[model samples]
Target: MDNISARENRQARLKRMLAPTSAVFIGGASMIPAVDNCRARGFQGPIYVVNPRRSELAGIPCVPNIASLPEVPEVAFIAVPRENVVGVVGELSAIGVAGAICNSAGFSEMRGGEQAQRDLVAAAGEMPVIGPNCPGVANFADRSVFMMDFFGEHDQNGSVALISNGGSYLSDLGSSDRSLPVAYSVGLGNQAMITAADVLDVVLDDERIRAVNIYFESIRNSAALSAAALKAARKGIPVIAIKGGRTTAGQRATQSHTASLAGDDTVASALFKRLGFVQVSTHTEALETLKMLVHAPKVKGRRTAYATSSGTYAVLGSDIAEANGLDLQPPSAEAAAEIEKHLPPFVHAANPLDIVSSADDGKKTLDIYRAFLSGNLDVAVNVMCYPPEGGWDPTTWDTNTTMFAQAARERGLPAAFVNTMPEMISRSVRERMIAEGLVPLQGLEDGLRAVSNAIRSSELAEIVARKSDEEILLPLYSANVTNPIALDEASAKAELANVGISVPRSVVVKPDQATSFEDLTFPVVVKALSADLSHKSELGAVALSLGTSDEAWRAVCSMAENLKKTAPEIAVSDFLVEEMVKDGVGELLVGIRRVDGIGLALTIGIGGTQAELLRDTATILLPASRDTIAEALRSLKLYQMLDGWRGRRKGDVEAAVDTIQKFSQFAISNGERFVEAEINPVIVRPQGKGVVAVDAVMRLAR
Candidate 1:
């Protein structure tokens, strides 16, 4: 099928699954909760229960079988035994059902369920299936709830969608007391036929969704996910995600620095950033971030204004704000003058303004807030903690919060009601804040971090907006290597030099060849030339800084002797003699490698022997522009030294960037022909001189 047609078909199936007109439950009593949940969510359509043994389920008469149903269901929830899931799905598919949620477990996740999973997929055919081991979906917007598990009462009017690979996590997030505005919740389960990308593509089409939060253990389809994320960016919807299982357990074992540094998690991080998704570390941050995005307008900048009645909160807020990259500048001179009029004589006007207890009056608090927000800030935050009911009268707290919200609204600024502790804010106050058009952020640290993430989302949106579809989409290639070839240093350098990257003048000669050194420069370096010698220095196969022809020849002989003792099984027949790079400013490691699920990734970082020890690297997914390459370079800490540190001469940064860009283009053009390529310690000379690839390695798969 064509791309558009396939997408349309997938989307159509998803629409039916998420908002089915008529549904059938294919099981006995275990499917009762799904039926009841669907009905409780106000599903007015007919719901059929299919079980040959039971005549009734959850007050509904059972139809006995799929053949006995009154009408063809738009969707089905199959909770039969694992062995019968395939047959049921095939029957539904034959009947032209839109989709099915295979609630049956023991597929793909179990030790001996691989073939069953494959059989399930084959049975599904073109019909979309959510999971064989997943909790079904819950769509609050259309009031279609087909979930197997009970996730507390939720309002139909919500703006965020939660999707997860783990069923329990989805249930927990849906039932959490954080009061997140949830529009849809889906547990992906095994993702038999339907993937997270497929779900996201359909979810993004919902106009009611303002933000999406996902918890994924792995990304099954990167290209589709990238396209969906680009659509989200264009539509100005933020995607917050928490990726599980971040270990490098099954990464390819290669001798290249790229493989060591650019692990699966690192590449995934780069992919998320490139796709303009906000990746959070914990569920709290994800929930808090979703609240920020759903409740307020996007923060335009980092300039923030913090206001609190307690001095301690003011100090804590200031510290948290700074730590999270929020720019909490002091109030302007005119605004300070205006704020001082409301504060007592002892209080000073500043950012994180402490309006002491003396200014307890509602009118004075509102005046102070108005004055504080007048300082040209992008966001306004108020730190307020309400005591438990009956412990203290909340009349003053309510009045102050109302005034604070009013002041921020009058100024046309996004505002947040931040509490020091998560439990300090009651449900009533949180709902009130939401009604007042303000975000009620629970924890101080998580709230500030969420604010930072929200602001970063805005920035990333702008960046993604400037990129074309071609640039935004990653070129994911299949990894089918039958014949693999690892190129020696000379051949690798030739490949790099062919692409306009600078390489030193070099000559490859046999160890037994009688060669004249007059053609080469006086000061030269010698190294054993063999594809098997990945770490030449560690293998005692490298010799450097020879000042003359005899010295170079002697170094080559010594290298042969050392290699014989180090690796006697290998025969080093040839050696590489090259001129030493002089007056170099620094070294850099530029590498490109294809990750299994992800596409080709370009990693640039501090090079030389300590590259892994420093670990100061930044990655960019390929099909990236030169501007993106430069940005990645600039993010590295070594960029400071390359750009001239402590009055030192600047390295040829432009040359380095150009080299990396060309290298990336070469990888893209070659596609699956090559698996990995790296240039360690690409000596970057002083500004205007150029960069030279001194040491290199490359592996090709045919």
Candidate 2:
């Protein structure tokens, strides 16, 4: 498949196969909600409900089967028994339905039915399906509702959109029953048929849908979703995602709730962070992120002014803002001075504009708020929790809050109203806040988190979309034959060294070989050279700091003997002897992964096995520039060590990052053909000295 042919094929698929589909065929007796939902949503398209026996439903005509459909249904939803689903999908495909939603049970999530699940997968080639056990879908922009709950009167804000696998969970937030701007949503149960990426592919064209809510149980085509997410971010449209599971219990709930195969959630978190999503946990919070997506004004650059009523809120917000890698700073002097006229003596006119909640005068409230929103301030924060009013007219608190809010809206700046009671904030208040284009957050923490995430996603998207240079994508090559696989340390380094990465000097000796010929001196580390020994050190397959040659020989002999005892199948190539890296300030773990929902993600964290347990890691999009790299590293909890902790000399942070950055680019370049690559303990020596990779592991995509 050449590029031209592929492009032509895709173009044909778009024109001949996919169009703004109207009237989807609903298949299943259990899909009563989907059928009822379609009618309530005022679906302009025709309905062809498919069931074994049903004459009429929701006042729409029903068909006995797919063959009776009046015309080639644009979309077909198969919600029959698992055994019958594949066959029904075949009929829908034969009749020319472009897309299908499979709500059948007994797929991958089914217990002890691996063969049945595999058979179900085989039937997916006929048409795209959402789930084998999904509740259904909803498209607010097109007025198509396939889920039971989203039919309630929703806000037509037109800026933000949501997609979720747990439709009812999110709909509970919609139960605020307040009008909102919703584009579409879907509860993709198993995603065995129609995928999240496929839905994005269909809806990305909706200009009315400025943002997207990507709800998922598992990420299948992460590359496609990443591209779409990046696209949305570049366009200043936000994607708020509520991945179904992150805990063992959550993963189990995902399996039982909607019948999905949930994997490691850390991967999902990193992916969402990279691919431009405001990741939330519950369905309610998922919608909360829409505040930032729809209300906040897009910045021309990364510059931002952070304002808060409380100094503490401002400080925490600033910390969070910077941590997620934002430029939250005090408002400019001119901006502060403008607000000073209204500030009380107790409330200093600071960047945070801490207008001490003690003030009761309406004029003071309006004056300070107006100054912050006077276009001079880029964004402002208001800590609203009904501050102690001394029992003044309870309505007085309401009046003051409303007046202050109105002033901010009157101006062009984006302001966030943070309530201390996160879950307690009324839905009506939230809807009112959104109507005025105000970002309302549950607490000070939530507010800062949402804004910071949006800013990072927006900035990274801009950077990636505009990128078109060599630096944007680095080159990598292995010195040894890559097909057979490069196992030796020297071979791995030769390949990495080409791209400017550093590797420890080493001498390789064959298994059972003597230390006499080993060129590397004493106090060296010995590692068994076998692909199977990926985590060599973990299984005592590696020895470090062998001060004596006898110890080095014994370690090598021990590793070889161990491998033979464990599994004679693993062919031992050679034993690696290299100086044990000890001069580095601290160990750093660098890795590149193609995330399930997002594309190329580069992760940097504290080294050793506890890395995953601590989750003390930072994630960023691949091909990041040096400036962004520095910013991301600076946000780490280990940044103090990197910055010369406890009088120890600072490591060559720039050089170490350069190597990690290069590795990330390499992984991205090989993304089409590789699954993931990791290099642990990229030891960074003192300043002026470079870093070296002690070991690495690369997993090829099967």
lDDT of 2 by residue, 398-479 (tens): 5455656678668665666677556555566666666666666775565666666566556655655665432233223222
Residue ranges of candidate 2 with Cα displaced over 4 Å: 1-29, 51-54, 58-62, 112-126, 148-151, 155-157, 247-266, 299-365, 371-376, 385-398, 409-411, 419-458, 469-515, 518-680, 683-702
Candidate 1 clash pair list: none
Question: Each model's TM-score?
Answer: 0.95, 0.73
lDDT of 1: 0.86
Residue 520 CA error for candidate 1 (Å)? 2.0
How many times do residue backbones clash in model 2?
Answer: 13
For each candidate, how many residue pairs have backbone atoms clashing (under 3 Å)? 0, 13
Model 1 is weakest, by summed lDDT over 10 consecutive residues, at 246-255
Q: What lDDT does each candidate get?
A: 0.86, 0.62
lDDT of 1 by residue, 1-702 (tens): 997898799898888889889988898788887888889888877888999998799999988778888899998988999988999999999898999988889999899999999999998888889998988888887888888998656787888888999888777778888888788998889887778888888889899999999898978778888888888988989999889988662255456888788888888889999999999999888989999999998898999988887888888878888988999888888999998887778888988887766445988888888888987789988886877767888877788788889999999998998887887678888899889978999888888888889898898888888888877887657854557788899999999889898888988877677678777775788989988887888888888888988888888877888888999987888999998898899999999987767778899999999998999999989888888899999999868898889999999999999899889988888977878899998999999999989999998886
